[model samples]
Target: MGELAPTVAFLTGAPTQGRIGVGWRTLRGLLGRPAETPTLTVAEVDTHLGDVATTSGSGSAARRSELLSHLLARATSAEQDFLLRLLTGELRQGALEGVMIEAIATATGVPGDLVRRAVMLSGGLAETAAAAASGGREALLAFRLELGRPVRPMLASPAESLDQAVEGIAEPIVEYKLDGARIQVHRDGDEVHVYTRTLREVTRQVAELADLVRGLPCASVVLDGETLALTDDGRPRPFQETMSRFGSTREEQVKALLLRPYFFDCLHLDGTDLLDASLRERREALHRVAGEHVIPGEVAPSDPAALLESSLDAGHEGVMVKDPDTPYAAGRRGRAWLKVKPSHTLDLVVLAAEWGHGRRTGYLSNLHLGARDPDGGEPIMVGKTFKGLTDELLEWQTRRFPELQRGSDDWTVHLRPELVVEIELDGVQTSTRYPGGVALRFARVLRYRPDKEAADADTIDAVTAMLRG
Candidate 1:
C-alpha cells in the first residue's frame, strides 16, 4: 500500500490479466531466447541447492553457492532476467494480501473467513497460509487477540446532514465529535499500550495516558477512544496542539501538554472479547469499566440541533450519530457511525500563486493557501485553489501577486504570506502531502480579506477540525 508512485504507475500500466500474458512466448519475443535448458523448479527458486539431485548443507556459504549454481544452471536468459526483477523488487504482481488469502483458501479447501481470521490474528499471510494448509479450519479459528498486537480500528463514513445520519437508526447514540486523535488503548495487567488510528504504538510518548488507563478496574481490556490536549479550563485544545503534543517524544514537551482520553467503546473486557457484540453492548461494557473517562453522549434525542449547539458550545467539532445495534466491523468505513458539523468559512494566507492553464493562461491562478500555526511559526499549507475566480479577480491577482513575491519558481510565484483571503470549503481531509496532515476539499475563494492580516488567519487546528464533518 505504501509503494512509490512511479513503481505503482509502472505496475498499473503493466499487462497483468487477459490477452497479453507474461509467458515464455512473450519472453522469447522480448528477449529473443529459447528454452535450451531445463525449466526452473519451485524448490530451486524457493531455496538454494547445489543441484536438483544434490542436497548438502554442511557449509553455510558453500551451500548458498551450490544452490545459486544449480538454479542459474537450469535457468534460461529470459528466466534469469525474471529472477533479477524478482530479487530487485521490480516485479510487482499488483496483488494485495486479500488476493493471497483467497488463493490459500481455494487451494487448501478452507473457508475464506477462516483464512482471513487467521491472517488477522497471525499478522502474516505466509504464516497464516501454512497454518491453514497444514492444520485446516480449527487451527485458523484458534488465532486470538494478543495483548500487544493491534487489531484494525473501525472507521466512520461522512454523512450529508444530521437528519440523513439518524434517518433509520431507532436509538442513535449522539456523542460529541471531539477534535482529537483516534486512540486505541490495550490494558493487559500492569502494562498499558496506546495505539493511533494507524495502529502505531506510542506507549512511551503517551506515558500519562497509559498511567490513566492503569487506574481502570479491569485487568485486561481493549478500548477505542479519542485523545486531545486540554486547557486549564478543561476545554479541548485545537487539533494542531493535540497533534504537536501527541507526536512529541520529549519528557518535558509531553508533560507540558498532556492528552486526555475519552473512551467510547470497549472491544475487550477481562477475558471476554466483545468484537462481535453490538455497539450498545460495547458502550455498556465501556461505561461499566471506564465510566469516568467515557465521552459525553446520549441515546436518541428529540432535539439533535440543540445537542449539536451544546457540542459546539463545549468547543467540540460536532456530534457523531451512531447506530446502537451495529457490530464493530474493524477497518471498514461504514454508515453505522455518522459525524455532523456545521460548515464555516475561514480567512487563510496566500502562500503562492501558480501560472494558469487553457482559458486562464497568462493570469495568476491557483492560489496556494496556508493556515496559521499556533506556535508563531510559518504558515502550514492546507491546499490550493483556482475556483470561484472571476476574470477581474484573475487580472487583479496577476498584477498584485508579483508585488507580494518572496521568490518565484518555474510555475509558481512564492508570496510573502501577507495577503489574507477568505475561503469557503466543503471540509478538510486527512493528507500526507500537506505539512498540516490535512488538505482542503472543494475550496473556493469567497473574497480577499484585506481587513485581516496573515497573523489573523485561521489555524491549522481549525482546518483539521473539519475532518469530523
Candidate 2:
C-alpha cells in the first residue's frame, strides 16, 4: 500500500501522459494480486460512491475526524496518498479514462466495447462495469443514475485547419467558441444543479444561474451549455478572468462576474434519455425547453465553405461538424463530432521558455512567443504554447536551447530571444498581461523557421490588423 504513494504523487502532481502510464501500470499490478475488496460495482465508482465514506456528512466533525485519523493510521503513507488521489479524482498520472475502461473490461472478462457503451450511456465509470461483471447485473443496476450530466463527449484532436473539418463532415454547425466554463445542468422538478465534468457540485457557486434555470419550461431536464462572463459590449470576458471568478472565494464577486449560460444541447427532457437521439432531435428539444435565456441556434448546412463563412461572420469558433444521425458517444474520442477553426499563423520571436514535465521533464518545453511592437519597437508577448512538438523536436530543443540559455533550472532553461517560429493561433483577445494589452488565443507551434529572422516575424500591427479584419 505504501508503495502506491509514488504513483499517487505522480498522478496528483503531474497528470501528464507519462505519469498516467505509471499510475495505470501500478493499478495493473494491484489488480493482478487478489485482496479483500468492497462489493460495490464499477458503476458505484463511476457514480462517485467510493469516496462517500470520507465525504458523508452524517457524523459529527470530531467523530468523522477520529474515524479519518484511525483510517490514516492503519494505512501506509503511499496508501494514504493513493486514497486521497482517488477520492479527489486527481488521478492524473497520464492514463486516460478510456484506458482504465479497457483494464476493467480485461479484469471482468467483459467486452471492452460493451463496457465502454454502458459507461457512456450511463455516465458511470469503468469500475461500474467492473463491479457489474464481478458482482453481476443486480449489483450494477442497483445504483440510480440521472441524465443531463454532460459525460465527456467524444472529442477530436485539434485539426490542422478549418478546411480539414469541412472536408471530413458533410454538415457543420458553427457555434461561438465562447471563452467560458463548460457546465452540465440537471433539473429534477424545480431543483436545478450545475456540475462540472469532474462531478463537482457548483450549485452554490452560481446561484443566479440556478435562478435563471428554474424558469426553463420543463418538469425534468438535462442540458449541456457554456457559462460565459460577458463584457458591457456583449463579447466574452478574458478566460483568466472567467476562471478567477470560478475560483473566487467571495460569493458577491462570483455573482458580479455576470455569467450568462448558453445551452448547446438537450440531453434529457420529460424523463427521456436523449443520448440515443440524433443531433437534430436534441437541437429541437433544446429550442423547445430553452426559452429566452438560452441562445437559440441550429446546424446551418452540409457545405463547408458556407459553414465557415457563417461561423466567421457570427464571431464563432470555425464550426463543429456533427453527425446528425449519430448517437451521443461520451467519454470517447470518436469522429462523431468535429471542429473547424480558421488558421491564422504568425512569425513570432521566442520570448521565454519553460521546463517540461513528465515525459519531457529534462527538456525546455513550453515556449512564450511575442510579436514586435508596431510603435515602441519592443517585443510584446502574444501567447505561450507547447503543442506541435514531436519527440525529435523536443530532443533538438533540449540540446539547442541551452546554447542560448540565460538561466537554468531543473524544469526550465530561459534563453534570450533569438529563435523565430511560425505559430498558428485561433484568435486575439484584449488582455492586461501583455505589454501590448492584447494576447493570442489557442496558439500552437507550426514549426521552427530558420529562414525567418526575429526581425522578419509578424509585427503587432499585423496581429491587430488580423483582429480587426
Candidate 3:
C-alpha cells in the first residue's frame, strides 16, 4: 500500500517524511519531566483531539502550539512516547485492520463480512464502527456503491512467469499491465470524478480526464483502469512523467503530460452494481460501455507468451493474467488476478535495518536498501524489504550487523553501508519518499554478495533507468 499512502503529514506541521519543519531537539525539550510532574488524565487529551486533529480548526497556529506544549509538559515519559508514535503513525501494537474488524464484529454481534464490506464501501473504519454500534447489522448492510464515491480497487498478486500465472485457470482474461498510475473513475452524468487506487479524489488535478469520462455513453458508471503519459508514438513515457500530474495543478505541466485511460474492469454501470458479478459478465459490460477505451486483451489465448511479448514490445511493464469466473473482491488480493514480468535484479547496499517482532523477535528483519551515489557522496536509499529472507539468514544478520553498526534509535539500527546484497525486484518507480527521488518496486533479498564492495553496487542512474524497463 506504499503506492497509496506514500507519506504521513500531521496537522501540527510535523512529518515522518519530506522536510523536518520543526527541530526534534526543540520538541525533545518538552518531553523532559518537571521537578514535580502534574497529573494529566485521558479526558484532558481527548478534549484536544478535535481542535488539533483537523486542518480547519479556528484556533491560531500559536494557540495550537501552546496547547501542545502544555499537553506534553504534563505527560508521563511513557505517555509522551505513545503520543509521538501515534501522531507519526509509528504506533504498532499488532492491532491490524483485519483484527479490528473482527473485534468490532465480536463486540456488536454483527457478521465480520458485513462490517468488512461496509468499511470497503464507506472508506472509513470509524464510521462503520459507529454504525455497527447504533443499528447493528441493518446499519452495516445499508452501505452500497455510491455514485461519485470511489471504492477500493482490487489488487493483483505477483507471479514468477506467464506459465505460473495461467497454471490452473481454464480461460484467463489477460491484459497488458502498464507501468502507470491506477485510477478508479466514476461518472455520474456530466459530473465525473477520478480517484487514485488509494481512493483519493484528484478530479480537479485531472480535469481533462474528467471531461473524457463525462462524455462516456453511460449515465452512472464505475471504471477501473490505468492512465499514463504517452509519447507521440503512443508508447508509454517514464512512470515519473505520469505520476507528476497527480500531485500538481500547474496548467502547463498538465497540458504537457496528457494521460490516456485504458480501462480493464467495469464495476458498475447504469443502475446495477457488479460487485458480485463474474468477470465474464463484467467484461461484456465493459466492452459495451467503454468501447474503444477498453484495454486490449484476449480470452484463452493460444500463445500467452506472445501476448506477454507484445505487451513488452509495446513498452509496457508486463501482463496481468486473470481468472474469468471469479467475482471482484474489493480491497483484497484475491487469487483471481496475477501479474507476470521479466525478473529484475540489482546489487544494493544495506543502509540500515529495523528490529523484527513475533517469530522474528531479537533479530533485524526488514532491510533498508540503498544504491551508490556516482558523484562519490553518501549512498541514496532506494527501498526496504524482508520478503525473501530465510530464518538462517535472519540469524546471520542479527549476529553480523552489530559489528557494522554506526548508530541506534527506537526503531532502526543505522549501519556503515559497507555490506552489499543482491536484490530481485519487479522494477523501479518514481517516488518522493527517498533522497534519490526513486524507490524500488516489489523488492526482495536474493543473496548476500561476499565478493562485492560498496563501490561495486549499482548507481542511482542505473536504478532510475529501470523505470523504462
- Candidate with best TM-score: 3
> Regarding lDDT, does 1 or 2 come out ahead?
1
Q: Which regions of candidate 1 fall more than 4 Å away from where they truly are?
A: 1-130, 133-136, 344-424, 427-469
lDDT of 1 by residue, 1-469 (tens): 1222222222322211111212222222333333587676544354332132243345644554444444555688776675434332223222234456677799889998778666665545665666776678887878887777877666665466889888988898999988787888999999889988756688888999999999999899999999999999999986657766655689999868989999999989999988778999999999999988999889988888889889999999789999999877653336788777776567798999999999999999999999977555568999999998989889999999876565788899987667888787878889998899998889998778543456457778767876886
| Residue pairs that clash (backbone atoms under 3 angstroms), model 1 | 49-67
What CA RMSD would you report for each candidate? 14.3, 14.1, 12.6
Query: Compared to the true structure, candidate 3 yields what TM-score?
Result: 0.69
lDDT of 3 by residue, 1-469 (tens): 1211111112111222322222333345456563255476444555554444442445555555566677777787777876655443233211245556687799899999888888788765666776788789999989999998888668776565689789999999889998788899998878789998767788988988898888888898999999989999999997657877888888898888888999999999998999789999999999988999888799999999999999999999789999999877764345699887787778788989899988988998899998877655568899999999999889999998876666889878988666889899888899999988898999998778653456557778768877776
What lDDT does model 2 reach?
0.60
Question: For model 2, how does the per-residue alpha-carbon lDDT over 266-305 read when each residue is reduced to its tens digit?
Answer: 8888889787788778878988998665553346555556
TM-score of candidate 1 versus the correct structure, residues matched by position: 0.58
Residue 294 C-alpha lDDT in model 2: 56
Output the number of the lDDT-best candidate. Answer: 3
> Residue 180: error of model 2 in Å?
1.9
**lDDT agreement with native, every candidate:** 0.73, 0.60, 0.76
